[model samples]
Target chain A: MIIIEILRYLFGYIEFRAFGGFPDRFVNLCTKEGIPLWNIKNAGGRITACTTIKGYLAVRGPARKSGMRCMALRKRGLIFFLKRNKKRVGILAGAAVSVALIFILSQFVWSVSVVGNTTLEDEYILSEFEKYGIKVGARISSVDLKEAAQTAVTENEKLSWAAVNRKGSVLVIEVREITVQPQMYDNSKPTNVVASEDGLILSLDILHGTAEIQPGSAVTAGDLLISGVIRHRDGSESVVHADGHVKALVKKKETFSAEDFSFYKLSYENKRKIIFFFGIKIPLGKSVPETNFSEHKSFLESGEMQLPIGIITQYGAVYSEEKTNPELSFQDKAALLGGAMYAKKLLDYSEIKTSSVTEKTDEFGKHYEFYAECEQEIGRLQEIYVEKTNDIA
Target chain B: MPKRKKQQNKRKNTPVTPFNPETKLEMLGNRELIIDGCKGIVDYGENYIKLNTGTVMTGVCGDGLLIKSFDNEIAVISGEITEISFVS
Candidate 1:
């Protein structure tokens, strides 16, 4: 029904009234001739109706036969519009050129983005893609997106998978980086498991080596816990690689200080804005002297598509610095203590079993000392040095 | 000829007669009447509208009666339709 209405609007329709004769006979004659009409109304001895352009022209025969007449009340549609404005050449040319400009502009990429990458920098990934003809202002129809993604993956060994997708005028490059794990020491080498810290050995499990100390033995930081020597029944000694987990009780300490706190007063300030379009930067005002500045960036976006137009705002401020005591409450001081002992860094490789804290204050600021007893894996591989001597058996 | 057969023969012989696959009248809450399979507009007036529904004449009595369209044998009449009656 909407399409019919639109067709009627596009092809042009006429609204006219028939009077002074039988209007019903005129309408029936129109239907008999296979002409379509709508919005029929009867008022004050006249029947008004709407019909298409062709129907209105052919309706003269039916009107004369029924002894009625039609006068086109209004003419509307695209054809009529063009006829009315055909003399204004400049307006028509300008409209045509604007449409053409939008078409050509949409055919080129406006922005490029990189997503789904960690460790690998966004600029580095973008540069890699730029080498493969994926960049701003490149013709989208001519660029091979799949080939670019494949070559990018092949060229960068760090990337396991990569994909390139175009969203309107914005080019999106998605990448997955390879994760490499640290390798352990070679197992064929003859080595011993030595203690990395001073502790009482809580438990010990040895693999490919002989036990040097029992669970209840106390060992220093450099003492060996697993020995690589093996004596056979024939009384001959052989050396093997040492591997073991030795859990021991270890003590750690951390300190936090507030002596570095300083306050600053603004001496002078300036705000600068730079307008950018399609990767071209144009400063809107004079550049200020370089100082400590907070920067903000915003881009013009249409829905989810980012246009290549943006603005950079810089609030440059000069300040006079002065040393001052930190304004903190008792709870704030205690919360800061949680980070003071960088000693909490031990939780990465050890579990804290017990802890104690000591606090001290000076004219500069307050200080905290954190002492903790932790269960830690103390055994680490150490190469054994031995002489190759010729012995007669 | 049988009555049904004679009617079917008349339909096949007339090409300009409106197709009568089915006659349906949908009344929208006494406000509008949409009629399908109408042969033509028999008579049109402000208080009353008459349509040939192929099998019988369908009359819609109302105030401010207007025919929205009479194309493809479908007539959509909208007004404060008070009553609808069939006149053979």
Candidate 2:
């Protein structure tokens, strides 16, 4: 039935009203004559039916023989529709052209994008793509992406790997740069190894300089521990950069005091509010009745695409200080303060070897003295300037 | 007397043939009727439609009867079909 309706719509059909005859005889004549007619109805001596244009034309003879008068009521289907809208021919033409244009444009690259490139610039990679004739507006069928990527990698020494891929209308080039390691120090320059801090020397492993201090030797800060000047057998000395590791035992001391009295404890209560507009904040209502409060403002962004208008949320946290008495005994307070000072002093050392803490109480307050012995690197690089001697001297 | 008996026996053994020649009538509920091998339309009306199928005349009684299609020796009549009967 759907196929028949589609055929009717495509081939075109006409609906007509028949009068002045026996409608049954008219239909019989039409059927017997092989003039296809359907949707036939009779009302008050008037008959109506629909048929294809050819069927309607062929029915004229049968209609006459049946003593029926025929008058077309309406025309339908594609042929009649095109004839009715003949004035808007340009619209159909434009639609056809746009379809063709889209098909043609999809076959070519519209834009070029570069990804995974850090040191290499987009323009540089695009320029390499241009050399391979794989830039924007290039035909996708004509471009060999594998060969282009290989060529790009071969041409640039800094690029370790490169790949060219076409994603719909975009030509993408992904590249990775070659990583270079740092160079070692120059040996021809003169440099000295000095003590980084005041410590007792533990050991020394000189790689390119003469050791001026031995184990158990005490050195102060800025004291030279190794000399970069090497005296040769020809009675002349040459300068070189010194490179070695020096380990020493350093002592650190820190003092802390605790008061045996009540202290103030601050409690933070937070409230949030949102504001719209740039840099202008209007408080909707008071969050808390506390007089002391700090507000942190942050803008809410929808996505990666930045828009000028945003929602600013102000997070206000009220800090109220309440007086509270200490809950620990005097000995416990002294031990806690001493342990805290010990940890603070240990932060400056690489490794702690031994530590001792002593607590002293006076009329002022309880005092904690913490001492720590640590092992650490004590070498600091210091450049030595050589003086040019005159030959006459 | 034996020949008459044989003729009666032959008549009893033979199968009866249908009156109409392969006319296919299909009814979809009470709303539509499709008739194949249709000869022509005998009468058309909103209340009833009579169709000729070479060997018999079929009358369809309905309200708002419409011949939806008539082609290739087939007729599709649609509407609220109440009854269908053979007039001849």
Candidate 3:
């Protein structure tokens, strides 16, 4: 119904008042003529109604026969509006130029974005994309998306899968990282199980060799816990691959000095924006080198079509990260423990049985001491490096 | 829906009427009245509106009575209707 009304509005219509004479004769004649009319009211011997433009033109003969006159009260609809504004050439030309400009701008790339990347940085992905013609202000027709995706996956070993999809004038590059599986140890050769760190043996499960260290016995790094040599009751001896899970309590200690902590006051003196258009960077004022920056971008967009022309604002914040002794807080203890865990491989080993920490902050320096006693699998496979000999001598 | 039992089932009690295209007068709770197959307008006024329905002359008495539209033998009258009478 709304669509029909719109069509009627586009075709144009008029409201008119028919007065002086037999109005009923005019209405009956108009109905017989099949001229559509609606919202008709008769007051003071005058009939007011709305009719289509075609109906109004055909209403004269009926009005003449009824001795009544219809004078158009108001004219409405699209055609009438256009006729009213036909002399405004500048406005019409401007509208035409704007539509054409939008059409032309939508043919170029407005921006580039990276997705599906957890570890790879957006700048790194975009830099890689630039090599394949996937850059802003570049012609969309010039970029070979399929070949670019293929080359990206081939060049970057970290990415297992990659795809380039176009959304209006914006280019989206999605990537999937390769998941590397842990390597398995070969057991065909003769080997011995040795301790990886200083630990007191709590439990041992020897797979193919005899347990050399007894439970509750303390052993340091490089101490053999399982021997590959297996002696039979018949007085014959043969060597086999020695594998085992040797759980032991290992103590580790790590410390952070005042030299490891530093503080920096933000220097906004080096802050300035460097605008980049397409692949070219334009400096609006004096430029300074910066270690990091935050970029904000905007482009003209109509619906999903983004215009290639846009502005990029880059802020240069100077953070020297220079070493200066400032008092260390509990956050430093976390850094100390993190360093200890990385060095001692505590998390990969096993759960901690006991832990303790001590910290000191003074004019001399800040110090953090971290200690942990954790039960870990201390058995490490060590190849038997002895030469094979048939002579007992 | 399930079939009713013999004792519970009963024949339709209302008579079925076929389609009738003669002049028909319908009143919308006395607020409006629609007269189909109207021949011509007899008198048009704020208090009274009369129409020729071939077989009878129908007069609608109301306040601020109006002929909303009249075309192709259908007259749609709307207002605060006080009475409706037909004279053969």
Query: Which residue pairs of candidate 1 clash?
Result: none
Per-residue error (Å), model 3, residue A10: 7.3
Off by over 4 Å in 1: A1-11, A16-24, A39-49, A64-73, A82-94, A110-128, A156-194, A199-219, A222-275, A279-297, A312-393, B1-19, B22-37, B45-49, B58-88
DockQ of each: 0.46, 0.48, 0.23
lDDT of 2 by residue, A201-306 (tens): 9989998888999989999999899889888999998888987989899988776665522234446655656464332345665565344544443444445322
Over A1-393, each residue of candidate 3 has an lDDT whose tens digit, in order, gives 579679878999898999998877887788888888766777778888888999999999999999999999989898897788889988778878999988987888887778899988988988887898888888899889999999989998888999999988788899998887879967789999999999999999878899898999999999999999899999998889999899999998866664664555666645455555655667676765465666676666667554545566656667656563355456764664566456656456568888777777778766777788888899998988768779886
Give per-residue CA lDDT, model 1, range A1-393, as digits (tens): 899889888898888988877776787889889888888888866888899888999999999998988898998887887788899998789878999999998988898888999899987998899899897768889889999999989988999999998887878899999888789757878898999999888999887789989988889998989998888999998998889899998877776665533446788888889887765688877676578877687989878767878898978878888654466765565555655444345354468798766777878557776678888899988998877899999
The model with the greater lDDT, 1 or 2, is: 1
Instruction: For candidate 2, give fnat to 2 decimals.
Output: 0.84
Identify the candidate with maximal lDDT. 1
| lDDT of candidate 2 over B1-88, digit per residue (tens) | 6899999999999886443768999999999999998888887776888888877789999888888888887999998998898865
Query: B11-88 in candidate 1: lDDT tens per residue?
Result: 889785343449988889988889988887787776887788876788899887788887787789988998897876
- What 10-residue stretch in candidate 3 chain B is worst by lDDT? B11-20
- Separately for all candidates shown, the number of backbone clashes (residues 3 or more apart, or on different chains) is 0, 0, 0
Give the C-alpha miss distance for residue A368 in model 2, angstroms.
19
Winner on DockQ between 1 and 2 is 2
Worst 10 residues of 1 chain B by lDDT: B12-21
In model 3 chain A, the worst 10-residue window by lDDT is: A269-278
